[model samples]
Target: MNKPNKAPNNKEFPLTRETWRYIKRRQKELDDAFLSKAKWLPNDNARLSALLIERGELINEFPETFKWWKHKADDRARIIDEYIDLLHFLAGMDGMPAALFTMDGGYSRIMFEAETDKWRRLSNDYVLEQLLDYSPNREYPVQSACKVVALATHIMGRLGFTDGDILVAYDAKNAENFKRIAEGY
Candidate 1:
């Protein structure tokens, strides 16, 4: 698989080609191990549903993002962890192309200039729209997958997360997932 090109124009979103490669390799390892134990692969519809569910879980970490009246401190660490959890499934989905990790110039810009809550809501809605477009019957599932990845990366960037943060969190979560599989989880 071709590695992603240079990092995007935004320095804060420093997902270098090496980082992308590591993520792909690690996720593949996790998927292979999981499949070996489970002995059953999910269909495209099932994968899509899992992605949607994970997205919901990630959103749930930031209640203040949607709840206008609920003012609470943002649990930044939990939010990032949830986002990485979503990535675990997204990266492992069947036929997730290497190009999904490639970030274009357009994605480097924030989708919304509004305040945190408004921008987060808008970005989440946009990502949901892309996720809803994915279907097993689609002529080009890769295209839909690409849209989701780009939107997902954009969300991370908007949240002010660095590529380093993703790598660290992914490693932690990945290790935990492996531990779970070993324990027959």
Candidate 2:
């Protein structure tokens, strides 16, 4: 069977529902196969904390003005890295199905606003934990997991991330992680 090509970027938004679903599915599969395989409470807590921290770092990338002397890391790449890390934690949860997330507007508002975004990220972590806590004790914490995935996708959009950037960055990071693992790092 042949599949038709997708239309190019929307210029305004970087994601599509189908693409978002695919990325989430891919992340879930990879996490299930690797990161979540030997789950631990400490690791879960680390993921949650890392996500909150990433959100904070991501905000820093947008400075009020750029200094000619201040050579900084690529902000876009940094955001993507943090975003993927957050996805990894969400993936580790292993709860949510891909269908729960999409590129549309139903997210909990994570725009360019600093104050609101910070608070939102905090609230999100709280909600994620609550979801996992209420879920039945099992290998996959489905309830909290899916909600997190949905929220993360929304965050991607709010952070001005694109589907192309995610696809590329994710592959690169995944490959690097594998290589590092193979090298016993």
Candidate 3:
């Protein structure tokens, strides 16, 4: 139940340990890839802008009866149509699991059992008390709570908790490794 009016304050959502660790891991991977690449492509920002503009126009002209138009109609017409137009391409939408937070529609499948339980156990009063305690600075608590929810979900899912529904499936070799470690004397 986040306030829909404003984006949460960044200070209130300062990165948690798991979130920071994930960011570091991603940075290391990016550095490794950059060092390994034998060739680099020149920046294509201008071409991308032109393409975006062209697609934006086409998307606006799409039949108003199009399926996606209904969901996005409340937003600025041009921006919503422009984004949906971009989603029309495979390269634009594929292979991006991490950038899903740009819009609510992008969440793949949110299994909220764990999230709901966490919130229930933590209690709204406790959260509000924390917000009040920090209120001298007027910091909102919603952002940090959201980040905690996300990181808890990721860490629990990664560790094979959360009913295994959100967990990534493992291959046979990894399954055997799990058994060996779990059964250690």
Model 3: residues with Cα > 4 Å off, grouped in runs: 1-14, 41-69, 72-185
Model 2: runs farther than 4 Å from truth?
A: 1-7, 36-46, 65-74, 96-161
Specify the poorest-scoring 10-residue window by lDDT in model 2: 103-112
The candidate that wins on lDDT is 1
Candidate 1, residues 10-125: lDDT per residue as tens digits? 42234444665577678888998998877677654556567667666666666565555777966889877877876666566535442333322212222222122233446555
Please write out the lDDT profile of model 2 over residues 35-119, one tens digit for every residue.
4435443344445455455544544443322233566654766667766665555544434243233322222232212223343
Give the lDDT of residue 22 in candidate 1: 72
Cα distance off (Å), candidate 1, residue 168? 0.3
Q: How does each model score on TM-score?
A: 0.68, 0.51, 0.19
**Maximum-TM-score candidate:** 1
Q: 1 or 3: which has the higher lDDT? A: 1
> What would the per-residue lDDT of candidate 3 be over residues 1-185, giving only the tens digit for each residue?
11122222222222223323332343334334443542543122322333345343533432332335454442233432332223222112222333333222222122233333443455333433332232111131222223333333332332223221211111222234335445651
The global Cα lDDT (0 to 1) of model 1 is: 0.59
Residue 165, candidate 2: Cα error in Å is: 2.2
132 Cα displacement, candidate 3 (Å) = 30
Error of 3 at 51 (Å): 17
